[model samples]
Target: MFNRRQLLGAGAALVSTAAWSKTANAGLPEAAIMETAATQPPLHPQSGPDYNPVVTLNGWTLPFRMNNGVKEFHLVAEPVEREVAEGMTAYLWGYNGQSPGPTIEAVEGDRIRIFVTNKLPEHTSVHWHGLILPSGMDGVSGLSHPGIPTGKTFVYEFDLVKSGTFMYHPHADEMVQMAMGMMGMFIVHPKDPNFRRVDRDFLIMLNAFDIDPGMYVPKVMTMLDFSLWGWNSRVFPGIDPLPIGKGERARIRVGNLTMTNHPIHMHGYDFAVTCTDGGWVKPEAQWPEVSIDIPVGAMRAFEFDAIYEGDWAIHCHKSHHTMNAMGHDVPTFVGADKRNLTKKIRNLQPEYMPMGTAGMADMGVMEMELPDNTIPMMTGWGPHGPLEMGGMFSVVKVREGLTPGDYSDPGWYQNPPGTQAYEWTGELPEPRKAADAQTQITPRPGSHNTAG
Candidate 1:
């Protein structure tokens, strides 16, 4: 009999396609595809929005607001277009048009008010992962309160009781919504003024996707499906490249919301783990580590002072996820090639010749047979077996002495040694003399105040 892990993995794999077919046949409406003709009237862009909202933390004011808000002031969830596979496009709900929404930055002891507005046809709520708060405000639809209804709004007010990086996502139909891209980062900074300042900071949330174009997808819960893809939302090399400069101290906030565990690896340096979902570890609890395992629905915060300068890759250490389909006997391409082969043969080709059937053979694509001599059976859950591969990966580059200003400043241009300079002028009016400027003053008591 197969073990439970194997079975769970297989079930998880099939959930996506199964859910898609079920939803389609049930006549559920299709989610609007990114960049496609609008299926419904577009919402009037958020009006008179506050692009910037102020949050007071530990008596310090920090800038915090949801992105993609009309004019940048409110939290707005909208549909976005993304390439799920070659020649395939899928629509995902995003904050400010990004799958993993904007990063909310705050210091410890800050009161945070997140105003979440639902734009989808369904009800949704925001869960503050790992943050200690009253259960009523936890954002679980049934457990916390009725979820925010479509076109309505809800406010999540909480305090940063601890300092660390956490995440936010929909608790209603989470497996489906999260896979569809309703998630973002939340960071609580330490109140200590003497904390080490890093040269740069970045947020990375690892998730997975089981999507086929033009269909509704569901969350894969069993381990069977979990094996096919590691991280649903591919971060490194899929969306944007992670950048680091040599000798720069980089702080990375990582969160894992996938179904399975991800043993994340960062090349070239062993960093210090400073915090977790619960908050900063005591001095005795701190330790040095290079790679860490992040569990589902948890967050981990670590700091790495770069020592080497190169493009170092970070990814899940699961053997199959690192290798494409584990050499499964699946076809690599579909459409024209598959059609031509089928036409030439006057019938369907070999079991593995059809598109989307690669990696399903009893013998591993590597030709390795099962130890028991039984033909390895393939299921319709995930891409292949529990050991399926290729998700949740990224890279970090560290270079020597390159400051943030070095890359962003217009006048101070620096190219790798021996590279030519590329210059461009910015379009902005030059500053005028103070004496030539017009001034308006509101009269009130003590109006005679002047700068020393």
Candidate 2:
């Protein structure tokens, strides 16, 4: 155990070095030395390297080196600039120079050694949130193990006993750390290469932040009123689409670290909830679903065959979750009289404009002023018009003749002629009224009817 004074002193010394290794001291066996080979076994053997890479959008995959039979990964915990949207960047604490950290990929039954170095001003600890590990390695600060002091390195060596989708975040000062976007995905592949194989496997972390408009740091205290929602810490337009070949087995592992649950909805295909962090769901227990609601601190893996050849919608079903920086307290003025109010306000303030008077859908097309480094409430221009999409929204592009290894964006789908909705030019139909109907309203004997 380290006292506050000792921890502070030790932390200061460790931060000076780039990244302190456990082998700094002379106590390493020949077999345990790090491997320097450029090529190694793929994390997901079933799907080759190209197809198995998890599309993190603005994030990245954590790289590692093999040592004997064990894999070692170094994670640096520090404040990083994360672009939540194209123009919106937030100062968040994460691992290896990115927020929502980097995805840790491993194979089941592999001995793994992870070294986490804290670079933040305050102390922190990395809790392997859903991994089954020894009590000390569980990483609950003050409970299972002492929190890592600032600038200090801590080693966690354990065998990945199971294969599933898991997550990691700070257990010490969890609220503040997680709210500042400290989290990551940990994926363990099955030892058997053929087990649960998929052609395209991708992962994403559903996260939320409460950065006020024009600000760069998220409010760590706000819970329910998060203005920025995202998949993989990135908003739409900035979020990349998932590209896959037509007629391939697609698997998407989604993990949520947000304050609320997300009902992830997909269009043009029905997928099955085939697995969870706990384990794989048996075929007898698995059921087909178009939307899967991942609760807070949980993960769900959905699988389906991409038989369609087009760009399909994939996003959270909650209307607000697909928008950015919307005012929650703004009154509903859909049918309210705002003519007099708008005139008076515009007279006093030339730029004043009564908003939401007609409806919010118009806000998507309205050229309203927005704060700097912030996205519009509703945005994203599509092939047809404004997509009116923002956070937690992206497209899954499935096309013919796509190379299995090529995950590049194929651009918007070009609808075939006569397949898309078009304007009516040759038809003119008169509105039908009840007066044209044969049946007419008649007064009852005792009713006080005015149509005599």
Candidate 3:
């Protein structure tokens, strides 16, 4: 195998040889490369309105340019290295950089022009989920339009007539493409900025993966038995917390593309579903909820006041969705007699030990070896103890002095004196046993005599 320096030299030599051969074959003094007509001119300056960009954890918004009064944004679909969780990385195909690509924020009434460059080995198309547009630009890949060929560019132009939380993904070979993590959120801010103002806005995409142990790519065929559940392609410990100002109105927009529904639960606030992909929900029709279930292929936007200041948990209510790399085939060992089996196994392996014969909670915090590129079923260190939680979990940090535009992590919260939950240290009182049933129930003598 060649070392780094040797590989660099070899790559340079190959490039130089290729260039010389191309020039010689052309019979020209120098190789001439012509630009294609599809390569449009650089965008020009515009005096159009812009939306208040929301901070998406492990994601970002695409910047747009005004090209002759049209909002132009570019998306490149290609392979990317995504950190699925701490110490676990997956090879995925996404737009620009990360899986669950950058958010696209726009204002209503803007003439939007999006250029999609396909860099995948296979053909793909971008479907603007829940967006109103011309049928030709629907990006259905052979149904509404032809698929964007590999190494080719396709431009989608349309007028944004409605404003709501939307999503985008590939319609061509969706199963394989989406399984490899190709998706993003699209937010069209209302033209009237103050119509529904929010101090802080956040967005997260719910997705799952079935990348087995020691595997780099996800098994696209595995649908119902996904192991790696996450928000924005990131597990609990890998996800960033949502920072907001206390007493400020906040909005969280979530889009689900996974096979399962996620009942998103929040610790400290009761939020109302304010908007859907279709449109806004009227105030009278809205109800307060601590958890909201988001179905697959749907988007929901919830809003609430950050009245309590602390590190509040926000996660999927499904217990399994909160775990990492758990094996479904592992046998239930609880209450099983393994003393003789352990001795026989250790005689051959010298280090085999029987575990989970009682319960599985200890495995959450146990220090055990795991397969390469695989995360623990539960892992995270908390102030109190091992959090023993992973996947689809994060915190909402509400601080007293945070600014509306501030996106920096405020760090862990500090509770007031004697406020945090702690174990009771006082002496326990003796338990009062219930009186015997025979002593408590006294039958009448006359009734017993009559019965006899």
Candidate 4:
């Protein structure tokens, strides 16, 4: 997860360079850059209309300055080294300093000026996805305006006519650029603070990468078989846990930039989809859901009251999405008898172990040797035992009694007496063989019909 919006919101410089003098906008603001990947505190409104800030999980907000009546921000699109997990890293193209670039937040009707400096090797342009603006500022290269040539800065001035969840990415060479992790979340708060407000607001951009083991850059050619699925360019347990106050209301806005859909499921509470990229869903139109299926290139905002206090899981329901670096072509050995093969393989290498006879859960607890800069297929140690999980996974740590704006992890939730599930040692009935059955009516366990 990314951190240090404070560095920009409060300080605004991780070695920011001088604005390009060749550009038209002479008074462009300094392009704030993030240097770390820790989840920093939310940037409260230093100026402009006051609305509750959103916490970008493993990410940060792009800082802006008030120039005249318009809010100004600088976005430098360049190469960045993003840590996908503890041992893995990827060199990707993104805005500012990280892949799935720093979030952009503004009000409903504020006039905004964004200076985009292309530090990339090739021509680039930033497309404001899902924003209402004039044709010239739409950022569609060759259609609205030409790409900002390398080492040049271009200004995009537009008015935020409406408020909703949105996204941003490159329009020029979109396939290669987006596949290399060039995307970000754009959240526009309502002009009126009380219009669908929540105590804790959070954002997550679902992204994926297809980097091979020991590689530094993602392989852009790979399509649906991404090896790593991430939230804001970070995998779990690298993804920061959402710390929620016991009785406070919370909102989670998720934007999917991947090639496929992801059904985000949250344990312990049923929420309602309050908003989308199109607009806010009316209160009467909201429907209760424990899991919301977000389609490709779309966004969904769900809200709920943090009633039950627990270390509830919030992750994609697709099983493969939870395993890191586990490729699609790995041969299945669930029912194959590898005992004989293991003997032959062990003769050549004494440490070779045949797995997946019963299941692959052993991979989570076993500390086997792996390649450098490679995340395990299944990892993470929980309070009980190994989590046996990996990508697109995070915990919502809800606890009682703490600071009102505390976003720190509350550790694992403690279950009350006799509340946790325990092992059962009781015996069950035995199965009768087909030979022992008299006249069988239907086929049952260990029992079959006489006629095929």
Q: Taking the candidates one at a time, how many backbone clashes does each contain?
A: 37, 0, 0, 6
Query: Residue-wise lDDT of candidate 3 within 356-379, one digit each (tens)?
Result: 776777866688777899888888
Question: Could you tell me the C-alpha RMSD of candidate 2 in Å?
Answer: 9.2
TM-score of each: 0.59, 0.84, 0.83, 0.91
Model 3 accuracy (lDDT, Cα)? 0.78
How many backbone clashes can be found in candidate 3?
0
Candidate 2: stretches off by over 4 Å: 1-53, 425-452
Residue 423's lDDT in candidate 3: 88
Clashing pairs in 2: none
Q: What are the lDDT figures for the candidates, one per model?
A: 0.52, 0.77, 0.78, 0.86
| Candidates' RMSD to native | 24.7, 9.2, 10.9, 4.7
lDDT tens digits, residue span 321-360, model 1: 5532223444344112245445556554343333232333
Name model 4 segments beyond 4 Å from true: 1-26, 426-452
Off by over 4 Å in 3: 1-47, 337-340, 350-353, 425-452
**Best candidate (score: TM-score):** 4
Q: Give per-residue CA lDDT, model 2, range 155-178, as digits (tens).
A: 888999988889999999999999
Q: Candidate 1: where is the Cα deviation over 4 Å?
A: 1-73, 83-88, 213-232, 323-390, 405-452
